[model samples]
Target: MKLLILLLAPLFVVLPIYGYQSENLIDFKIKDQFDKVHEKSDFSDKIVVIVGSDREGSKYNDLWVKAILDSLEKNNTGKHVSFIGVADLSAVPFFMRGIVQGFFPSDTTKRILMDWDGEFAETYKFKEEHCNIAIFGKNEKFVSKYPVQKFENKIFEQILNDLRKLFSK
Candidate 1:
């Protein structure tokens, strides 16, 4: 029993325990694909939307982005909302980072932040193999995290309704 406990202790220390904690998001600094540093302070006084995904969940990111963008355009709420994309690259080996980066688009308009160490994902308790959507109101106050296993209209509408309520306030 002692031997088994000793062996498993290291795993517990190394692996991130996933759970949603209701607390304000602490400050963090991370670089985007364009090497632009984005910190919590940068999003002050804005309704920030953070869309994060691992490699498997990445396919659904664009659909969410499009839906959010379309909603913003239709409601003329573009100025109130800020979108940030975070790619969970913790699984990518160090040597493969450059190769993986090469696969990203060259567009300068949108920024795709890289969570190289999975710190952000762990902090947010992101669901594996699913798109994670977190919204923060002004002053870095965490509003909610939408569990998105796959794109669904009902879930999307709920998100939009929450955003609309936030915008109205």
Candidate 2:
């Protein structure tokens, strides 16, 4: 009985546990098709442009989304931009490209955070649930939020201008 009690005591006792993972382990997370982990800390040192749109939006707004993706993928410009997707995790496995097809031409700054629950979007004040894009500064702070359905070239250009300012500083 003492032996059993001793054994059970260890089981019941709360002690330091090893190898626990964080739910928001942004660092070292693999992107869509790569053998790399997305590092969250990296954004602190660079400007990030995140896009989060899913479902029907991704289908109908493919062109516009692609344009954004293409812009991100441009030569030597990605270092200053990051994209975060706030969509269904299941869908991410299948349609990361559908959402990021053109936006990920390159990995210049590597600041993409895929927020499935829309927490980040909500915090950034984008409730349109369509083509939403936000820019985070080198301080790892959100500087702007732009929703797609209500966007004009001016807004996007303004976002670019904001990004340029971040770089300039």
In candidate 2, what are the lDDT values of residues 69-148, reduced to their tens digit? Answer: 66656635666665555442333445454554345435644333444444444444444447666677777765766667
**Shift of residue 138 alpha carbon in model 2, Å:** 1.1
Shift in Å, residue 91, candidate 1: 1.1
Residue pairs whose backbone atoms clash in candidate 1: none
* lDDT computed for candidate 2: 0.54
Candidate 1 residues lying further than 4 Å off, grouped into runs, are 1-16, 19-22
Native-to-model Cα distance after best TM-score fit, residue 28 in candidate 1, in Å: 1.6
| Candidate models: Cα lDDT each | 0.83, 0.54
Residue-by-residue lDDT tens digits, candidate 1, 50-141: 89989888888888889988988898997888888889999999999888887776898768888899876878887788889988876677
